[model samples]
Target: MSHSTKNSHLSTTVANLKPSGIRRFFDLAANMDNVISLGVGEPDFVTPWNVIEASYHSLEQGYTAYTANAGMIELRQEISNYLKHRYFVDYNPDNQVIVTVGASQGIDLALRALINPGEEVIVIEPGFVSYAPAVTLAGGDPIIINTKPEHEFKLQPEQIEDAISEKTKAIILCSPNNPTGSVLTKEELIKIAAVIEKHDLIVLSDEIYAELTYDEDFTSFAFIKGMKERTILISGFSKAFAMTGWRLGYATGPREIIEAMVKIHQYTMMCAPTMAQHGALEALKNGQKSVLDMKKSYRQRRNFVVNSLKEMGLDCHLPGGAFYVFPSIKSTGLSSEEFAEQLLRKERVAVVPGNVFGSTGEGYIRCSYAASLKQLDEAMKRIKKFINEL
Candidate 1:
């Protein structure tokens, strides 16, 4: 179809939305040979055998039907218990939890439920590629806050206080952050909470990597004093449980906001997959060992990758959690995109350009340590060679 013809059928918001930069590099790598990809943020581990068996058993027991719009009560209750025990926060299973297709969907649902046209939502960078576009799609303007590398990429309280406006409705926060892998400490969160409470703004806290922290215990933003009632916590089994393909996640928050999200979910997704919900229930009940095991491996890989990048003279931070390392490519005298693309073509290594995450990321590149040590070692060698040749 011609561009004009396609534009006639597409809403301006949908048409204007930029495609995900991560996927673009993944596609380029897909068509190449012998490429070692450190681009995607997904875990390299398989789903735990127990979780898989539970899903299989659900199918055997004839549980293949659509679940309640909010999801199976048993699953929701398990999620509630897990959060309380792990994070010292509580949510009523009946009205305060909704199982989502993925944490990605939970983000979309939260924005659509809370935002009206022309309102603004604060988005920090370098952040997940989806945040700004998701806000735009939900009819909210995204007010960008660029956190500096000197601050360890953690959002500062002053940034939040300065960005507030009458049209500001909510803020999206992710930690251990995706591209940067920076986890916000409890003291830092308390400072941020002070700002949020002072402004009375709602927070959509994405804790999808909650179980993957290496250096410290993960702190739930909702657990901050006076924050639970105003924070929507979005998490899932994807990263920690290595169940990305299962497509299961959830959100817990104030009953009213969760109910509004459910209303939209019922008209759209209906419910998370019934089989996946059953699998996730098992994950919450008995998958702690698997979670810890994967966390151990990720911690090792994180150290190895960070050391490798630093050895090769790339300025890299020791990420506190998650499996990504954002290393500055500035000394190589190349833009983020040029460095990533040329490295892929010449060295057969695929890492995402940092600028795709946000403008503040322009001089850096994001490399995931989620690959095996064997693959990571080889990819690091290739990357070092690429830089040397440059």
Candidate 2:
């Protein structure tokens, strides 16, 4: 019953995991007055009205029960069709697709299903905070490949080749990546695919921000000629459809891998929420315009944030997609954590310290441009003032 005794009862894997740096700053901002948060990666838009109505309608029709383990057949078909139409990838809805609680769950499922004890999964860094830990919890050692700012944080094929070893089994990739907003182009992917093919490795491609790319066509890794069999495509309605609270996402890949993930899902999660599934169905059917409109707004915000940061002497990359801009704060001679904390305390503006994503992020901070233009303008002014005073 003692504190130390309780700690001993916890799994070493769970106990040793560091708390999310994003949430720590979010909590600090939550306790402060008049704080403008540019930390969280969630969209500022509400879910489309038709999606909301459909979810409510599902309940009225006495559909308040569990769906099939893989999800409703119609929703799966739509997911299949959407991918084929939008990104030119084909998946058999019957066995190749699974509706998940979120893309986060899809990541967890893929890792658990693919990894054996002591195997290694390559994780590209300045990446999602969950990735390395998820590999660890799945009993795989995470081999980190740190992408650099000089290269715009894009992962190179040589980097992948350098990290692979006899025990390496998989890799996690995010285009329009979280925190960095750096999108890998099709050419870049073709090169990375070569390395994956050479190693005969599986890839967990997180495309949650696929719809948010501003200046280029979004390419699915599975759409590449020979990569589909080795790629598990994970995506959701959270970013594009503005449905974060819905907690609905899905994955599609080779039937065998999907079957393995579904086996775990049935025992652990059973199925994704029924109403959220219904809402997601409506989103895929009628949410294109809303997605485009939101993408436009986010694109504008991305430009504003990048310009503002550069004007104030910060080194910022012009993000090609997603609602985040990772700007280097090293010029200010402050650590990422120190800059984030001081800005929150002095300017009442909340941003996440980039080091939490990985060591490569140590001198930067991630600022989400998902807020209203007015709020972004004000946050920029406060940030400028804070830098000037320092």
Candidate 2: residue pairs that collide = none
Q: Can you list the residue pairs that collide in candidate 1?
A: none
Query: What TM-scores do the predictions have?
Result: 0.98, 0.98
Local accuracy of candidate 2 as per-residue lDDT tens digits, 1-390: 232436387877777777787899988999999999999889988899999999999999999999999999999999999999999999999999999999999999999999999999999999999999999999999999999999999999999989999999999999989989999999999999998999999999999999999989999999887999999999998999999999999999999999999999999999999999999999999999999999989988889889999999999989888899999999999999999999999999999999999999999999999999999999999999999999
Per-residue lDDT tens digits of candidate 1, residues 1-390?
A: 333436287887877777788898999999999999999889999999999999999999999999999999999999999999999999999999999999999999999999999999999999998999999999999999999999989999999988999999999999999899999999999999999998899999999999999999999999999999999999999999999999899999999999999999999999999999999999999999999999999999999999999999999999999889999999999999999999999999999999999999999999999999999999999998998887
Give me candidate 2's TM-score against the actual structure.
0.98
